[model samples]
Target: MNRNDRAIVALVTLGHAMVHTYELSIPIFVSVWLASPAFSADAATLGVVATVGYGLFGLGALPGGVLADTVGSKRLIVGCLLGMAGSFALLSVASSVWVVAVALCLWGIAASVYHPSGLSLISRGVEARGSAFAYHGMAGNVGIALGPLAATLLLLVLDWRGVALVLTLPAVLGAVLALRFDVDERAAVADGGTETDGGEEAGDSKADAVSSWPEFVAGSKRLFAGGFVVIFAIVVCSGLYYRGVLTFLPEILGDFPSLQPVEFGGRSLEPGRYVYAGMLMVGVVGQYVGGRLTDRVQPSRVLPFAFGLLGLLALAFVPLSSVGLLPVLALCGVLGVALFVVQPLYQAAVAEHTPAGTRGLSYGYTYLGVFGVGALGGTLAGGLLTYADVGVLFVVLAGIGLAGALASFVLGRRA
Candidate 1:
């Protein structure tokens, strides 16, 4: 692709990332706000509300993919951003649990529209699909890293409603910018098209170019065979382990008085929260470094090693309770990097295995594994925490990481 196309893809991807970050922040702060007197819900009920959003996000991916393929990725992206901003604004004004739940569901649907559309745009727009995907993935990581930090800072002064109102501005601006930018899906495909020596009819060529639901289903079935199944299984495990711990880190840290807060720089700060954000920030480096390495080495080699390190480091969290704050921070940062580094590799692998015509659906199914099926981690972790200690949660996560590593190793051998 030309430089102009690349720049457009980069800008659009960044906007999509920022909008998604805003949607994700709702869940991150839900627990905090729920504890306040203004909200009547208990911790478990709030967790359920957050889980509902995640589940809807997973369920909406296929429809989002179909819409992107049928209408246009750019349109879906712009619509989703605007819709998310509206949902957040609604959430800010909501009074009851029912209203909050409905608002969250809307946000979930909006969040669902992004990945299929944004990734499809990148795949169609760029000649070097792998690198383009890495950049896109990094944009998402940056949003994920910054979203909670931004929410925390906003909450320091504003009420939960005020925080939500402030956050909506970014999504609104992203929607306006997306609408202004022109991305021609037809041109992108035509640029990459190859002529058949048989001189096929225009109708036949058009039919071959567009993918339907049945074709997408068939492609997903094909992915279940051979090495692809192994990769999928590994991704499922990784999602379960990673989300399980990261989602509840705030609650877990709350149990440790020493890690909770101390006077720093003449202001009170929750050291654990900042430490968690720091870990997420380091994930950007991990993702970029892992992407670069995967371009050179096999994903099987890189993924298994990262998972192994993740398992070992996760175990350190148990003993590090007494180690000073910096040591704990370093361990968390390393583990965070190791956990997130494999995402781009997995995405690139899916793109590599699927045909171009079915790429959008392939991504939709991949997210089903990552977001839909893998989203169970949060509920499972929450249940475990209700009874067991944080150490047990760490052990369970480590076990899942080991399972992913084994699957990656097996898939590598088969490949």
Candidate 2:
């Protein structure tokens, strides 16, 4: 990678990690809160509270995308980082469930700004888009893996409040680093001076002003006319599948007989959390492989197979876990691979399907499908867990993945 590529990757990767860090940490907080003798919240009630935060995280994507397009991606990203840091800092002091809820909502709004801005940065700023996306996704997976682990570990030392406070430092540092090092998104686009694979100008560099509502509306109309709706549908299915499976993944892993608490240097370690984090860590490889594959092969071709395999893996996990710990762990590894392998593919797909000028807007809608709509997966999983069993939940997830696979197949032909 060149200097510019390195800068962009570092910026986006750190931002991506922070986003997942905040997201996954919430569940740890919930788990801790529930375990506390001082507080009482049933599983369903807690799910509702958590859902508010996650829902806003998704809901904020559109506006963030608009800001990325109009105001500039760098500004939005910087603001997002600071906002997230401040919100988490506030969360550290939260005493009541309502305060936590409000803090999470604030975090959600802040966290929502990331995807549209970061993805837009990759689409416009980096020349090696596939590699950049791969690195970015890998960083996010790292965050996803570490967030829970860190929270779990930190809880052993500090209170949840301290953990929240500590997490804020990274975002603050990230924001400062971004301000100092991350290039202006529009200027980067101008420097790269290339059209997206879909054949539109990177953006209007001459006009640094935000896009008007009329132009934004017209652009959306044109984007839909250009058939981005298909990509959007595929993303929604992917999001549902992703959220449904992962929201309860650690809980499911805890059910494994072999994954009991193990003592490590006098500290009791819950293997389930480690196992969960370890499995997700495997996605680093997936991101690398998937990112490279998109650069060489048609991302559309990769999508159907990836999503299809994901569905099959989801179906197999229950049966496999019934067999032995080894079998289940193997399944987890493969599932982890499958989980992240499609990110860069579909991210590449979004860029491929949408015009370069509107890449930020396109990513905004795409992530709205992934994160915004995907946030429902937590609620859906909680509902199923309440009324149904894990078997039914995996079945639903598998079905969602199958639908995404089919959509991807059609998308491949269309592309």
Candidate 3:
């Protein structure tokens, strides 16, 4: 990797990390707020608020993709950071439910831009695509692990408001760093310099021209015609499974007698947060392994195994939890690994299947399915838990995973 590649990787990696940090940090705040008398909200009402935020995260991806192409990926990324920081700042000062909703909405909109912009930058700008994707995914896993850990630790020291304010620092720092780094692939393509390694030219000179809604639609149409629609469907199913199982994972883990108090650093910590964060930490290995595999094996081949196993594990999670602590912990670790392993596989698959011309828009729709439409999983989980047992919830999640597995299998054949 050259200096430019290092800068791009650093920028995108930081961007991906911060996005997950802010996202996962919200649940911590929700837990805190639910317990506080200030909110006076029931579980169901708070769940709805969280759902709104999650839904908006998904909803904002389309326009975010368009902006990535229009305004430039770097600019959009910087905007995402600044926007997330501002959202956190707002959240820090939030006094009512409505204010929290507004802040979360802002966060959703801000965070929506990152996938399209950062992934587009990597797919187009970086020389080592697979390695970059691996490192990027690994960075995301790091954030996934650290976000809850940091939030939980911060909660012990200060109020949730203070935590939100402190969390804003990272996005601000990331934004400043992003501004200093100049590795915009779109700009490079416009300069007629080949930025990608032996890859296709970024796009035609006409692609450098400004894109409007009509052109954006036409590009999406082309992507669909090129068989990316199948990938989109696969990602949607993956999203549903991912969001459903994880939405209440910490609470689910809290049900385990063995996980009642996870000890660390001579302190008995909250089992739910540590267990959840530990499982997410295991995903770092999965991210790195899955990422490296994409450079060697066919990404399609990697997809079915990971997705299918995730389905089986989702079904096994409840039964395993009833058995003993070690088995349940093992299952959670495997679940985390399987969950993240498919990410890089499909991310690489998306890059492989789409043309450079409309890659950002393709990623936009991809994330729309992954995050936007996927946000429904939280609501789905809430409804199921309200009416049914945990077994039923896992069964539904298993079904979603199996559906995704089937989609990936079909995608493999089609691709």
Candidate 4:
């Protein structure tokens, strides 16, 4: 990669990792919330409750996408980092579930802008798009795995509130780094033909201020009319499977006797939390592989295979949990790899189906599908786990994975 590509990738990589760090950390908190005396709520209630912040984390992508196009990505990304820091700070002092929900909403609104802004920047600025995405995704998976691991370790020494305070440091430092970076935000798009809004000049800087609602809607219409419609369904299915499987996975694993808490040095240690974090850590391999494949193969071609793997893994997750500790840990690792392999594939699919001009808007819609509509998976898993057995939950998850596979198969056929 050239200097410009390195700069752009570095910026997005930091921002992407920060976004997911907090995103995955919430589940670790959810497992705590279920057990904490501060919240007099059940898993189903907390699931629906967590969805409040999680939903906005997705639902706001539409407007965030619009802002990315209008105001430019760097500004939005900087604000996102700062806002996420503040949101977590608020969580540190929250006295009730209502406060927790409010803090999460703050987090959601702040984080909602990252995907559109960061991904759009990469799509528009980076020359080595696929490698940049791979590096970017690896960083995100790092956050995915480490965020929970960090939380688990911190919980050993600090209260959850103190842990919340510590999470703020990274974003604050990231925001400072974001402001210092000298990046060519439009290096890839400077070739022209990408900044037009209904024939007017829609430059990235404020002098031109690329703003047009009518154009946004028109662009959205064009995007969905093409292969993006199928792509949208595929991402939504991805979202459902992601949130459904991950939202309660830590708690679910705790149910297995094989993964029960161990007496270590006179203290009970929960191995399930580490297993949960390890599962996500293994996803780094998936992200790297998926990202490399995006450069060498058609993402649509890989989506079906990846999604099919996810379905099979989901179907087998519960059955294997009872086998033994090693088997269960092995299943979690495999499931994590299969689950994340679909991400870069679908992300690449978005770029392929849409134009560079509307890249932010397209990714906005993409995340909206994954996080917004997909936020329901948390509620779905919570409800199922409350009223049904682990068997039923996995069955539902398997069905979602199969559905995603089918959608991608159609998309691949179209491609």
Candidate 5:
């Protein structure tokens, strides 16, 4: 791709990243705010609400994919951003449980539009899918990291409503920037002719041919055959492990009295929020490292290494919690970094396996695993923490990571 095209794709990716950060921030802030006396909802009720939003996010991917294929990814992306901004604005005014629930549902619907459209744009628009996706994932990691940290800081003076209002500005700005970029989805595919070569030229050519829904379904079925199933399983397991850790880490830290405060520059501060933010910031580094590794090492080789690190980190979470604040913070950062390394690997693997025409749907199906099946992590983590000890939660997550590691090994051998 030329420099201009590359720049446009980068801008689009950044816009999507900003919106994603805003969408994810709601849940994080809600979890914190619900615990406060200002909110009447109980933890269990808020958990239910969060589960519903996540479920909607997962379920929305299919329609979002179809819409991107039909209308245009650019349109869907901009529309979603607008919808997200409006939803957050509405959420800012919510005073009752029902109002917040309705607002959250809208947020979920808007959030759903992002992945299928944004990722599809990268695969279709950029020359280097791996590097582009790595950058894309890095943007997302930045959003994920910044959202909660910003929300936490806002909470020091402003109410949740004020925080939501503040967050809406970025989404509105993102929407405006998205509108400025003339990303023609149809033209993106039509620019390159159809030919199958396992190189950059082929990647560019495949980007030009848009597939119909029927073709997309047929191609996706083929993907599920052969070794794709193994990759899919690994992705699902990784997603579950990721969401499980991220959803519970704050609450887990909040429950522990000793590790709650950290001495920094001769002043003590509640470290839970900072630790959570630090973990996400580290994930951005992981995406860049993982993306480069994907270009050199086979995903089969790279995935096991990443997952092993994650598994080790998961096991360490329990022990580190008792070892004082610094160890816990370090572990959180390491786990956060390692947690997202699998994304580029999995996305690259899917791109390798599927036809170019159906890349969006292929990604959409993968998101079904990531968002749909992975959405279960919140409820599962919540239940595990509610019924069993937090150690049990860590143990279960560690086991899942180990399982993903084994699947990666098997997949590598098969590949």
Candidate 6:
């Protein structure tokens, strides 16, 4: 990576970490909500509520993508950081579930623009694209891992409201950092060719960049008409599997008898939260490995294998959780790795399969599949957990993982 690539990575890395930090913190808050007498709601009902906000997080990506292309990645990112900070500040003051939902809604819209904008910048700007994706994901995992831990620790000292208020600080710092870093989004585009896999020049792809709504539709149609359709399906499966598994994971981990609450600093703490945080922390290694592999191996070839591992892990997750603490903790660590390793593979796949000009639009729709449609995973988990046993939920999650594996397999064969 050159100095320019390093700077770009620094910017996106900070932004990505802050986003996930806020994101993963929400579930930690959900447990508090469930216990509160102010809002009496079961797991399924809360799940649906969370999905509404989480869905918007994904749903808003279409316009966010277009906005990324039109306005530029840097500007969208700054807005994202500020919007996220404000949303969490709202979360700190919530007296009812409705307010909680509203905060999440604002967060969804704010955070929605990030992947499209940041990823577009990296794909077009960074020379070491694969490495850039790795570093970007690694930083995100740092936030993912730290957010829950931070929130949980804060809970011992302060109320959940305090934790929420404290969570807003990092993004303010991220926003300041965003203003400091600058890079050429077109750096890689100039060195690489103008042609897409579909044989259109880069300029041709962007001819309609700022055009009418129908052009956006036509562009999407063209994008889907090619092998990107499979890419689309693969990401959907990825989102489903990822979101389903993660949305209720802390709660799920609590079901394990072996992972009971612990006393630390004279405060009773849930070890499950720590376990969840540890799981996410290991994803840093997964991100690094997955990103580096894409630089060397064809991401398409690895995609199926990666998804297959996730499937197998999900199937094993329930059974392993019942055995003992050590085993389940170990499983969580492995599951974390298998879970996050798939991210960079698909991200690289998107970059390789799509054109340079519409990178923002491509990643926009990409996350829409991931967060938007994928937000359903939360509801699925919530419903399953509400009505059925952990075994049933694992069976359903296993099916989603296997489905992702199958879709990835098909995409790999085509590649």
Instruction: Give residue 165's error in model 5 in angstroms.
Output: 1.7
- Backbone clashes in each candidate structure, one number apiece? 0, 2, 1, 0, 1, 0
Q: Better model by lDDT, 2 or 4?
A: 4
| Model 2 regions more than 4 Å off | 182-184, 187-210, 262-268
After superposition, candidate 1 runs with Cα above 4 Å error: 40-42, 184-213, 263-268
lDDT of each: 0.70, 0.80, 0.82, 0.87, 0.73, 0.85
Which runs in model 3 stand beyond 4 Å of their true positions?
A: 184-210, 261-268
User: Lowest lDDT 10-mer window, candidate 4?
Assistant: 196-205
Q: Pick the candidate with the highest TM-score.
A: 6
lDDT top scorer: 4
TM-scores for all candidates: the values are: 0.89, 0.93, 0.93, 0.95, 0.89, 0.96
Residue pairs of candidate 5 with colliding backbone atoms:
189-208
Evaluate model 1: give its lDDT.
0.70
lDDT tens digits, residue span 1-415, model 3: 7677788899999999999988877766766776689998755566667778877887788788777766778888899999999999999999999999899989998999999888888877777788999999999999988998899898777888999999999999989988988774743243463434554454563364238867876787777896588888888888888777777777667767777756677665677777888888899999999999999987888788888898899888888887887898889889889999989988888877776656678788889999988888877886787677789989988888888888888888986
Query: 394, model 2: CA deviation in Å?
Result: 0.6
Residue-level error in angstroms, candidate 5, position 81: 0.8
lDDT per residue, candidate 5, 224-309, as tens digits?
A: 87677888798789868876777657667766665466666665455676677778888898888877777787788788878888
Give each prediction's root-mean-square deviation over alpha carbons.
Answer: 3.9, 2.4, 2.6, 3.2, 3.3, 2.0
- Order the candidate numbers by lDDT, best to worst: 4, 6, 3, 2, 5, 1
Instruction: Name every residue pair that clashes in candidate 4.
Output: none
- Which stretch of 10 consecutive residues in model 6 shows the poorest summed lDDT? 191-200
Q: Alpha carbon lDDT of residue 343, candidate 1? A: 84
